[model samples]
Target: MKLLIVGATGTLGRQIARHALDKGYNVRCLVRNARKASFLKEWGAELVIGNLCKPETLLPALEGMEAIIDAASARATDAIKQVDWEGKVNLIQAAQKTGVNRYIFFSILNAEKHTDVPLMEIKHCTELFLAESGLNYTILRPSGFMQGLISQYAVPILDNQAVWITGASSAIAYMDTQDMAKFAIRALEVPETKNQTYPVVGTKAWTAEEIIQLCEKLSDKTAKISRIPLGLLRFLRGFTHFFQWTYNISERLAFAEVLASGKALTAPMEQVYEIFGLDSKETTTLESYLKEYFSRILKKLKELDYEKSKSKKKKKTPFKSSV
Candidate 1:
């Protein structure tokens, strides 16, 4: 099957492209920078230089493709409207014009319920557009990426920095990007997954306190936990309107409260596995993912320490008595 992967340079999109190639599908990628995407050619992907923000570029990329997987996301608030909303609409139109058979999209879990949030609102609008575009579609609503949590909470603990947990008792599930990519491929291949939506969740759920424990056990590093009340999270989210921020700190804090309330957690979906015939892959645990990442962090720290020690010795040598 010939497949075109939009946003092929992104974290999840690249993985999907690689997995599709590994599965022996002919892969094409819509890319903005041919140089950055040169490596993808080595991985057996045909790179079509184009930006999703420009509709004229999408037609050439969408041509002669059986399916399109949209994993694109905006980096900033303004880009969200242009890229996520407008860009996806452009792709849907191009796909319809080209008679593309299937359209797969990765949207965040609970996006339909969070229309007030800017990012979610964009995704919600895009989902509506895709459904009405007269193309066969499969939508995967994945939980937060496991990497996001590990980078934020696990890395800080490994580096001996304080990580603040808003609700100690809140439990949330996170999926590895690799797993999400694998499932996305299945959705493309499996007949049962067509024209359906699935909540692609992690194998297990962890509470905020349990998250710290897992990291502490795996890295052998103590994590300083600062617990904040839920009320404070609401107060903090109110501050997002004062000025623009990149990390979406306000939405993050607000979502933290949702995780704490257990509202965002995905319940077990036996039907998803049964219908898709998804085999049990290796479990993705925080301890397992952080082990190697912590080693790298420790290695970098040691390198910096060594450099500082060498500089100190050079200084202590007294400059050869100013000779």
Candidate 2:
């Protein structure tokens, strides 16, 4: 089947495109920056230049596509109205115009539960539009990404600093983007998956302290943790909105607020596992994720240190004038 991956420039979208191609599906990526998509080209994905915020540019990308994976997201709050909300509405219209089969949308878990949150509210709006569009659609609400959490704390832990969180003792559900991409392809492969809304998550839920322990074990270093009280987080939620004209509530801050309220619970994994048998590798555990995350960071730091030492040596020998 021919598939179009929107937001193909993103990590999740790129993974879906690559996995689809590997499965022998005709994959086309709707991308804004063709220069950055050279890697996609090398992987045998057809790149179509278009912007989701602009409807006219979407026509070419939507034409002759069997399905669309809606993976687009705005980088900041300013573009949320345009990209996440309007962009998706535009894409759905174009897909209808082109007579597409299935529309697979990626939304975050707890989006429905936390409608007051700015990003979640926009995502909920898009989800509703897609459902009422009368098209064969599958909406995936995956929990927090493992990569996102790891990247956020890796530097702080490496620097021997506290990884401050607002979640306190609450548990968080972490899902790997690779697993999300795999399930998206499965939805395309299975006809019964159409018109369904799934809450995707990792195999287990973990508390902040549990995750810190895993990180400590992997890095062989003590990790300081500072968790903000839930009461303060609640106040910040309202306080940030009051001062919206001055300071923008960041994604991290927004997520911390959500977690502190104990909203980030693991999805119903048994139901998902019943349909698609669990592959241990894809449903990664917190321990495994931290180990790999730390290993990669250590390797990169070593490479940087090596480069610096080489530069220092070159500078030391450069005092002799070239004659």
Candidate 3:
């Protein structure tokens, strides 16, 4: 089947495109910048320049597409209403007009439960809109991404930098993007998955403190930690909306306020795995993923140090051999 991946330049979107191609599906990417997304082209995906905010450009991207994996999401610095709200409405309309099938939408886990949060409210609204659109749709509500934690927690700990965390009681079941990608492509083959909503999460839920402790053990370095209160984030969310330029700050602050609300973002996955016909053992665990990442990074750092030492030694040995 031919598939189109929206937001193909993003981390999860790229993973979805790769998994789709690996499964022998014709993959096309609806991208905003062809130059930035050139790697997708090299990986055998057809690229079409389009922006979700611009409704006029969506038809061309949606043309002749059999399936759509909408991984497109507003960034922290983006206009949430424009991209996540208005832009999504436009995409749904275009998909309907073009008669697209097998629409897969990625949403946040437990988004409906926290509609008071700005980002969660937007996601919940979009979920309702898509389900009511009369299209064959599957909604995937994924937990925090393991790949994201690498930069947010692991890297900072490795570098001995201050890691900012909030809501020590907050726990999240973070899944690997690659695993989530597998679920998306596999959904196409399962007719029962149509019009279904599944919460895709990891096997275990972990707290912020537990994650930091694990990072410290793996890196063998103590992390400099900075704690931010959820109340402060809530204040910033309202305060930053006063200016146009700072609106981006307000947009992302909503997420911080919600994620740090001492809530657990988790769901039962046995049914999800059974429906998708996947074995639980095949999923990537947080421990294994982090171990591999740290191993690779530490090896590279050692190689760099060895190369620098050799360079200095060569200079010191000098021209005596030539004379």
lDDT for predicted candidate 1 compared with the true structure = 0.80
* Candidate 1, backbone clash total: 0
Tens-digit lDDT track of model 1 for 103-157: 9999878788777676777777888888888899999987677878766687788
Model 3 residue 247 distance off true place after TM-score fit, in angstroms: 2.8
The regions of model 3 sitting more than 4 angstroms off are: 167-169, 317-323
Whole-model Cα lDDT of every candidate shown, in order: 0.80, 0.80, 0.90
Kindly give the stretch of ten consecutive residues in candidate 3 with the minimal lDDT sum: 314-323
- Number of the top lDDT candidate: 3
Local lDDT at 74 for model 2:
81
lDDT of 3 by residue, 83-143 (tens): 9889999999999999998899999998998887778899999999999999999999997
- Candidates 2 and 3 compared by TM-score, better number: 3
Q: Which is better, 1 or 3, measured by lDDT?
A: 3
Per-model TM-score versus the true fold: 0.84, 0.87, 0.95
Sort all candidates by lDDT, best to worst.
Answer: 3, 2, 1
Per-residue lDDT of model 2, residues 108-189, tens digit only: 8878777767688888888899999988999988867887776567667888988987645558788777778888998887
